[model samples]
Target: MADTGAAIELVGLTKRYPGDRQPSVDGVTLRVDAGETVVFVGPSGCGKSTTLKMINRLIEPSSGSVRINGEDVTGLDPVELRRGIGYAIQSSGLFPHLTVAQNIALVPRMAGWSGRRVRARVTEMLELVGLDPGEFRDRYPRRLSGGQQQRVGVARALAADPPVLLMDEPFGAVDPVTRGHLQDELLRLQRELRKTIVFVTHDVDEAIKLGDRIAVLGERSRIAQFDTPEAILAHPADAFVSGFVGSGAALKRLDLTRLRDLGVPGCPTAHQGEPLPQVRARLRASATDEMLLLDRRGRPVRWLRRADLTHAEGPLTEAGTPVGGTVTRDATLREALEAVLTDSTGRVAVTGPNGVYAGAVRLEGLLGTVRGLLAADRGRAREHQRERESTRPEPTPPEAEGATAGRAEGDAMGSAG
Candidate 1:
């Protein structure tokens, strides 16, 4: 919100320690656009975390430059530079003696905000992070659960409304389920805040899920590859990057695509008191085995199958099998696919805003989408191979020739979801 999120640039950024044979980060160079989330991922001692800290001056670079929003960071005071960037680390990092409200108010208070404004900010951040302010405010950090403490850490970081956020495996300490929930919360918050985020994680899956562009790091924090997740998935720069992505690349791509990307049709729907004849006609026209029944308010109530209609149901609500659940339009393809698999008729219900019955995504229709996406992804990979070959001055490397026959990797670039 402050003059748009900061755009970060690291040119020849290097850090070395006394008695070290090699620099921890060896002349790393990268650029992060305003309001983008770029994750640095690698194994331990790869310089991923070290490079992340240099952005906010948590660790001073021995040489080179760091810039935020086109201004050099080195000339500025380290404390002031840090104050403008939000930082969250593992295990919440909350002071056990401080109450939740106090923890969140720290930055705002330091920035000389009035007491009234600080309090208002504390309450607002709590709500933004999905915590009940009244119930959690007075409680000390020790009273909160792991997940709750993580939320408070995020709220504290965002309290000052900084233009950049530095996250160091922020969700790493929580249990698997809690970690997943925290990731979802972070993603939702990002959609609203859109801060330039530099997140450091050793987990490839986490990096793929969170980053708009992922910087796959190698020894000494060298950038093995830096590109969009789709590009990386479709075209790994080298064997190291591909090996780092590991197996299940195709399945992982599914989460990146949303249901709306494909115009998946929905089954017919009618209100509870609608005329049976009209509802019957609607169902017959769809040429499907079932239809969705909606409440008077347009929310889904149940599924009306072919057998129920043949029985001449008294009302639309009383007709067809009851709807089990509904998938929102914004849901990912993996979510929609799961719904179809669990659904009795293999016809998943989809909803519009506010749970209104929207359309049905039949299993057959969903499969067609998957086939098309996979095909396109393979095609792109092939094209990338051709381009690389044409641009190379020497003979093609065996790795470049690893294209999948007629298919290219970029096919899954956007539609994999």
Candidate 2:
């Protein structure tokens, strides 16, 4: 998600309940950019919920300031501020007495919208959430399924077109299938609306899936790490973050991974009309050590190693040597890794749908791609650090003789006088 310049800044935010020895949120300082979704994730009582609530003044911070869009909101009128922000919680908190349209239109009405405006907004939001306005407008929450009610709750959250959205376990109470559907719907909605969203969840997978960046919290409400999903998975900050990410971090990475970013490069091909010797010569010139044998139609027939060709009884033909197992282009890196590990050959032949050779994929190339990606990542991190250092105010250098001609002349004149 691109940062839209909308931000929620917490400056040393802390919260302590009466009689509690430890703060629910302790010395937390974070910035959630505009039009970006930042998920707060951790175990039970990690202060994720408390932190989320504090964003909209649902829970007051024990100390420090909360700023939204660069304005200090710590002392803002809670009712007025919340009315301008979207809020959704577990169980799709809809009023049973109100119809779906009425429920979704609550915020607009509260904001002093006229009847026609409210009706138009209700229709628009229901359509936005994949619900037909005509089909569900008059239906009450009690008449709708749990999933439908939650969808309506989400629609209601967007009714007023609020710039910021606070969601606390919005889909947690739903079944797995419903949750998955809602997740996809939410992603689609976010892509279109680009709301500045602060989402709190205990599910790490959900956080990884939904968040542009995740803030992983620890016990006593401490933030262990906050970073992109790929960075967090590839290089966790510490043991706590790693364990929190779980054992299948590699598999989770697949979701963020792309085949175009991996290592599969074009290789030399043998033409059908070219003589066997010509093909062999081309292979030697290419310096691949092995040549792929292609048929008259330019489809791979077999692999001919240099050693096999040197000891050949006659000119090479399709029957001379044959290739073995092949993999497809869309295969996962995990699959490619397995193929490289199990095969006797160091390289795997990548083919197309009809078994035509696409290109060659080698372990070395894969390693190279990984190394390049990592180096680029390191460079970016160093650049970011440098930028941060530059942005910080530097201390003035101590005054010294010869550094200022004026100071030296004044000192000399004073001494003479």
Candidate 3:
């Protein structure tokens, strides 16, 4: 609703339960900048979840401090402190008895907002998460799908317009396909909302896809590596971090890189009702054998070839195969690669936010661009190394003069003899 985000800092945060010999989360110190999404990813029992809870004091840390925008909040009243931050968890944590609107209105209403403001905020949040407010406002948690429940949970979390959000595996309970969609939705929301997010997950791929920086934790919340996704993928800090990164690091790098950065080429396109003769001429004029058909709004609808149009159909609407797959510019190269491999044409259409056709991408071009980028990065690295070496001063040793004099004396004695 508002551009609200604050930096979060954890200073030696530790959590120990009574009668336990060791702490579950020990000495976890990190800083998250405002509007940055930092993901804590590690193996099970690594205390990632425990570390996240300490930030919001869900499970208070036995020691250490929590700071929000340079203000230490650990000593504050936990109830009042929590009211200012948003929290979402797996299984949605939505109340079964409450309707969607009521669930979203909880925070704002409790914060002393007027009824009119609360109602308006509920509608705005629902729409922000892509749900029709009119239809879903009255629905309960049990009546919604797994994905829908998660959306509602997020809406409720953001209802109060909190400056920071703590999400502990919020999409873990959904199916893989739905989980992917939810991840995309979160990315879209972050683009608009820019909330300082600390996400906890066990999925490294998910971390790479969503995080501005990733903290790979070890036992007792030990941070093995804390760096950008690209840095972690290219050069892991140690053996544990390398193993956690798993196989296919190169492919994972594709996820960090976007398609728009590669500069996708445009393809021939025609409107839905365009004349067949004109479509055929356009397709022939183009280098490729296929052309994309767009509806009135310029969204991709179908793919066409000259052979499919030989029958002379009435409106070009049903002339050819449906546009089986498409990707947005924000989509990763890995996603585009998957779409390309699945398509029969060895290419995939790219669309903008409004689903309007933007461009097309091919397998060869995508791979070549990645290779060029990698080579360029290497070249820059080598150049940097050479510059550093050239600027470094040479060292002179005190013993060098004596050693040289002794060597000269030995040579003179040998010549005289």
Q: Write one digit per residue (lDDT tens) for candidate 3, span 313-363.
A: 688886888988788777787888888998877888898655779988988
Q: List the residue pairs that clash in candidate 3.
A: none
Clashing pairs in 2: 6-34, 302-323
Instruction: Flag regions of model 1 displaced more than 4 Å.
Output: 1-3, 260-331, 335-366, 386-417
Which has the better lDDT: candidate 1, or candidate 3? Answer: 3
Q: Candidate 3's error at 181, in angstroms?
A: 2.6
Q: Which structure among the candidates has the greatest lDDT?
A: 3
Q: Which candidate tops TM-score? A: 3
Q: Would you give me the overall lDDT of model 3?
A: 0.88
RMSD of 3: 6.0
List runs of model 3 lying over 4 Å from the truth: 1-3, 273-287, 296-298, 354-356, 377-417
Query: Which prediction has more favorable TM-score, 1 or 2?
Result: 1
TM-score of each: 0.74, 0.63, 0.85
lDDT of each: 0.85, 0.78, 0.88
Q: How close is candidate 3 to the true structure, as a TM-score?
A: 0.85
Estimate the TM-score for candidate 2: 0.63
